[model samples]
Target: MTDSNQISVDPNTRGNANLIYILYLVAIVVGITSIVGLVMAYLAKGQGDALLENHYNNQINIFWKGLLYSVVSVILIPILGLGILTGLAALVWYIVRCVKGMQALSAGQPVENPGSWLF
Candidate 1:
């Protein structure tokens, strides 16, 4: 149900969409950026949801976990030799995953096929 006063998305009202887009871009730099997008999207429910909040959150979770594991692997690489690849791989993979998630969300879709992601 909708109310008479709610501000829905119009092609003309590109402001909020712009904000969401900027936030999504920010996510690429630090996956945690999705948090800002999520909050903004939720707060703008009356203006229609950013529709990417959940996807952003999921991506953030996966990103941070991947980052943590990558950090650990990097720290262990000197002792474990050849393990540095794992950290680099994890970082690359997560970046790809987060990018995909943000893309899907921006398209007003849920990021369903992240491929074996834990969160």
Candidate 2:
């Protein structure tokens, strides 16, 4: 029997949360879609169960971290001429985080450390 205190996540909510990764992927092409995804993630965060909540937190971190990396990359563009490489590394990091989150969500599991900066 399921414990009364055990939280159960809705499958539909899980699917919707998974869509955030897709939005992150799409953001590669549209650029603005990540913003939309971030907004959606923030809105839905409050409604999630433990697992979904972890996914939301991971997604939110990905967005903010990516933004911070991008800003740093831009600032370094002229001074160090390393912005291109840094930007690409940031993009790869974002993709990896999204992919990893989606994989964990698909397995009906919470990420080991949602707030972690590394994948």
lDDT of 2 at 61: 93
Best candidate, lDDT: 2
* Ten-residue region with minimum lDDT total, candidate 1: 8-17
Show the lowest summed lDDT stretch of 10 residues, model 2.
4-13
Q: Candidate 1's residue-wise lDDT over 6-114, tens digit each? A: 6544422434544554664577677666567556555554544445345434544564566577687878799857567776677677656656665665566766744
* 1-119: candidate 2 lDDT, tens digit per residue: 87876533443388678778888889999999899889888888878788888889889999999999899999889976899888899889988988898999999988788787777
Angstrom error at residue 1, model 1: 29
TM per prediction: 0.50, 0.86
Q: Scored by CA lDDT, what does every candidate get?
A: 0.57, 0.85
lDDT of candidate model 1 versus the reference: 0.57
